[model samples]
Target: MVSPISLDALQTLDAIDRRKSFAAAADELFRVPSAVSYTINKLEEDLGVELFDRTRRKAELTPIGRLVLEQGRQILKASEELTALVSQAKDGWEVELRICIDSVLTCEPVYDLIESFQRIQPKTEIRLSEEVLGGSWDALCDDRCDLVIGAEGVSPMPGFSIHSLGEVEFKFAVAVDHPLTELATPLPSSAIQDYPIVIVADSSQHSPARSMGLLDGRSRIVVPTIKHKIEAQCKGLGVGYLPYHRITDALEEGRLALLTLETPRPPEEISVAWRRGNSGKGLKWFVERLQQMTLDPKRGLQSADN
Candidate 1:
């Protein structure tokens, strides 16, 4: 009678503690505020203890409530790991496959692969997240994703199955009307510093943010994605590097003019990484197909598996 609590009630209690209010917790759990309150009340009724201080304006956890939360999170995590372990050992397919995609790569191509994969294995659900630089790796290392594609380098933390996707050539480019084009070819760093460089901010949460191609003491316009950086550069709002593959048509059509740097910037090396372990059929299906796919220069996207 006074022994164990349901995982559902524990989860509701944890959510209430995290969100700090019944209504807010309801919003997070996608349930009605009354439902959240009822769940908490039922949990307290079963546990034979008061979990919150209703006298205060804010929801303050009682001493016992704090104790429940501290242990509740552990139970939630262990439940997740066990579920994954069982899925791997007993069932070849996973319930879902979470992937972290780098922003520099286009989503259309990856979607193509997803479409193909679903034909053969329609049960596994796929969720995709876009991360920049170290954020992609962080997602995999933090167990947020089963696979990471277009990550900046070979797996930095080790124990990941790393494979080179290919190196992307970076070209110093600006709008046709940009003052940078008026400057002499092979722009020098001193001359370059006069203009603002557009950059994509790294979106790492579990790790420190990474900056790319930021000159010391130079002004920069930091944007959240590659598309924004492209738009800013196309309007002559800033000067910076764009992936050659991305700007090929723009360069040919005169929307962008490639500027030669006195010291050329190196191409960005990219790789696909996944954690070591049986990731189940969904993830394995992705890895095997991704390894065979390559960027098709003629079509301007990844082609069918080679």
Candidate 2:
């Protein structure tokens, strides 16, 4: 038997529930308020359920109405996915592509690549978000993103493919006026232990959070991004190892000074990664382009195409 509910009515219900008024829903749906009201009224008549408590001044969903709205959103989401899947099947590209970028790397080069990609596939939407450390890999593993750039720490799991973007070297640095700056080269751990250390907090949600250059019993100042860590160190708030590429200006301007450490941080190997079995042209385009290049510490993504 055919159900009395229609997709259009469900959409109107959702719009009203979200927009909070018939007039607002009408504006969103590009229809007159009467049309929006009529749709809801007709749906109520067919279903024999009052979706809203009309006695209230503001449009509010009843308990049954809330249940319907909750279920209706899932239906709408599935419908959208089916439509996009059909479109993707026809063309080799996807309707949208989401990319997660590691916070250690600058986004300028990635933006340049995006500009190049849009020349061919302008209709496809590109979404970019920044993740720190293992968060990039976590985003891909959890299906939160289709592709990741500069993913580090975790090795390739069973579902995704990865290609090296090369290693980023780190340098032990402190503000020029910091107490550590006055110490001898190859500063002893005992001398450094008294000062505070700055660090970027890991952004991973599912995996264990990772940190670098942290010392036991040392005062720590934690910030959200590498840029912030750099700023904090420059202000004489703390001392830590920072990516050499990101601090050239600070060093040249005499804002921060590098120190030799007995135990230096090893260079980190970063990579471009994407979930396997994704046939979308956007992901393939980036994977191919990124695999040919290496992440230059001073120059960002380095290749002939760049």
Candidate 3:
């Protein structure tokens, strides 16, 4: 069905209502007074409603006219936003930015980055998702995410570029009262192989899955995220290396105890990665900001409970 209202008609109505006279509205809209009068007359005729009170020398909006003006102002604002979005698209700003963060790192810093980005590009949409182990790199390879943080291990192929975010230190930990804590210091894999080990299931779909700090022939308690692994290990449900930054509170509270291993898990290098040749403004904004900042999990807590 055809609507009686048009954008031009709404603009004329708004100008006349604000200026309080047809001649003044014409001056504001850069149109002749007769044109403004004709527009309001045609709109009232089409809608079959009197939009103005003619008894006064000044144009006074009727109750319905006031409502229409209020609603029309919102439509005008949305149209202006659409025009700005088109302009941004021409300038290489993406309509949306997708970020994939690995579970090994703290998300608080990422949240801070997003908050800062919103202040500059409020029109652009931002999306965030968690990936485990190789899933971060996989997200970029599959084009599921535009940027990946804490992407560890070797790149699956050679098309992605990466910048070091810093390294996450892993420590062997167990619940304070767990049987493994009773074992001698510098515990060897043979001493703890019988205990269940908590592992975060890799999120990779097309890429091969990866694991760390697991010994041969151990009972596995696979969880979906590093946060869960911490909880499981703190409860004595399993034993494994937890990111030193993520488990500091547990260690301080005596919920968990760290043990030395004959061969300790080395610090893993975490990086920010993006596909080569895809240089959207949003992607570059993140890459530049992340490279300049430190990703110390100890200083950046994931949550208050942590």
Best by TM-score: 3
Ranking by lDDT: 3, 2, 1
Q: Model 1 compared with the native: what TM-score?
A: 0.68
Write candidate 1's Cα lDDT for 171-238 as tens digits.
88889998777778777778777788888898888888886556542789998877787788888888
Q: What does the lDDT come to for candidate 1?
A: 0.80
Clashing pairs in 2: none
Clashes of each: 0, 0, 0
Per-residue accuracy of model 3 over 103-127 as CA lDDT, tens digit each:
9877887888889999988878888
Candidate 1 stretches greater than 4 Å from native? 1-90, 295-301, 304-306
Could you estimate the TM-score for every candidate? 0.68, 0.71, 0.81
Q: What are the clashing pairs of model 3?
A: none
Clashes (candidate 1): 0
Model 3 compared with the native: what TM-score? 0.81
lDDT of each: 0.80, 0.85, 0.86
